[model samples]
Target: MSESVIGQVATTATSQARADVIDGFLGTTRRYTTSSAEGLKQAWDECDLIISHLALGATTRLIAGLLVNKKTDPGVVVVDEAGRFVVPLVGGHVGGANELARKVAEGLGATAVLTTATDALGLPGLDTLGWDTSGDLAGVTRAVIDQRPVALVREHPWPLPALPSNVTEPGVERVERRGTHVKVLPPPADPQARILLSDSTAVPDDLPTVVLHPKSLVIGMGCNRGTSVAALRELLDATLGVHGLAKSSIGVLTSVDAKADEEGLIELAAELGVDFVTYPAAELAEYQVPNPSAHAEDAVGTSSVSEASVLAHGAGLIVEKTKTPEATIAIGRTEPRGRLAIVGLGPGAADLLTPRARKVLSESAVVIGYRPYVAQIRSILRPGTEIVSTGMGTEDMRTALAIEKAREGRNVAIVCG
Candidate 1:
């Protein structure tokens, strides 16, 4: 199980001791003596889970107006001063408060008060179905809990577990034609409200849709050594827009290995919130491409950087190379690798590290950091693990290396002090 950074708040010393007991059990816990609004605010921002040794109402009031979304908010658990009941006061499902409450209750021998309907009825909510999914989560979940019929449409052959009886496919018995529907396909012509699951850049602008981008697009480029990020951004936006693609669908930005340290490409990828990867020119030259350039081959030892790099990663080119004054860009769609965990290990002390941090480190094929930080976790790494470390003043180099490894479908952990 992944451990959590728990924040404990209490008013009195006795309450603090009780909270400390729960903290010790959870590990990675910090105690806050001040129950003031400011302290609660700081905890809300810093911790993954917050346990307040106060009444439910008081806890709710302290965190008032700070709630963002189910995806980003911290799980809030409230325990009565007497420690009789552990209640998940907010972020019960998506933020993992319900699970945290159960763990706390089990540790303290208290009752866990859960009120989420899916948990109560022992059925998985439609919203709980993982992936980069977006839609009428509340509407579909409500329909499922009330046993109303729902339509599920999928374009790709993604393996979904057995859904509840209330949720059915397009052609099932007693299927509701006019009720809420979930679609896991490309944008349809109809402009009706529905949940959309797609990684394609093209989506129906006319529909009341919830778009789920699966991070399937890869952008390949070759640019002048000092090309400005603005120029790259303009070209990228135009290219993607011309192809009717969504920016969020992009998974990574790629280029020739020589451009690995190209500041413009790196900055653009960072601004787009995607990984940047580079392949050697000799490696890229091996891939057959539609537009082989003699000039490119003479310059970079590859006939084509934009097209060959895309195909080198086992992706089919969607848009052929489009050129700007000093840059060439191409787009490709590939099978999704999907997820990455970027963890921060504060202070480098064993006691200070969270269980989740350790779990991530043990599971990673590549452990990267400053040399001293890598040495701190040297004993716990699995056999045959790849350790990539750089000396001081090389933080960006190590980070880029870690991202490159992850882009190649390896779990990577970067430890920091």
Candidate 2:
């Protein structure tokens, strides 16, 4: 899913010539070319994006029956007969039609006719943040666009783009009891419309909120030699449920190296779709956990296995060791490390951009560079990427800004021409 499959539909000789030029800019070795209606259907089934050198009306008519949804459908971009104007026909924001159209226009020296409201206004679309998001998308986006107040509730500090001023953290209030004032607590903001950043599976009741979950939790486990996977699963599920933590937030399952060959831990990690890692006993013994055991020291040369392994990886213990007859489990929260990529865009041409540079650009949440250089790679950026473009002679300032953005846990790309 990281790389996109591009299909070129060109029945006429002139269209085929245009397709060849676009293909060179795509930087893909495999070419899927089709010339008939049947071929177009096949392309739709296999391709992630379709470049049709056909009339806008004709392309629409052909793809009308194949449309599934913006989430599932391939982006469709139509290039005119003369290759003068490129237009995004469908899935403009969600399926990457807008970005693909920009790339195609750059290669052909044509204008990209973009009409998406958020793109036109230089605002981040809600659907394009590369997170699992749902609920009140259009409503929240409209609130942002209109400069209306939109409250942001976050369970953890995530590396995100610079949002507009309209989206702000909510205020708190003090509630009073029958006769005395109680503790001060922050009431939920805009129950009818707000954004919630939480990895917990529990959804707020009767609230029109958009939820975005961040991967932050790590699970540390220590099990007996032949613990059953079913027993371990039951204990893990109970731990998460009792603590109101989401299993989706579990990023890694770790233990001491003594359990490296344990079948139960390996199988459970695989079933949960997370990485399984182990730390050596000598390494795990460095961290002083609250609940250290002499029995564990005699068994594995480490005073603590479940808690020490988590702290060894720079995570804070959110949950202490909870154990069953044969297994022990602990949960910790880890901060995400930020990344900074200084990419060189050779020759300022679409075809000249290297695959590695293009990948960094697309994965970055923020792109900082000179105005011209930023514009050159703008088409390759995913939706919701914040661009910080300055004039020439500001290289030092741009580099500093990029570093600061990365420090905030964002993937930042500083593009140079």
Best-matching candidate per TM-score: 2
lDDT of 2 by residue, 297-384 (tens): 9999998999998898778999999988798999999976678888999988967898678767766777888888888877767554
**C-alpha lDDT values of all predictions:** 0.73, 0.79
Question: In candidate 2, which residue ranges exceed 4 Å CA deviation?
Answer: 10-17, 171-192, 205-207, 219-239, 247-285, 289-309, 320-330, 336-417
The Cα error of candidate 1 at residue 329, in Å, is: 3.2
TM-score of each: 0.62, 0.64
Error of 1 at 95 (Å): 4.0
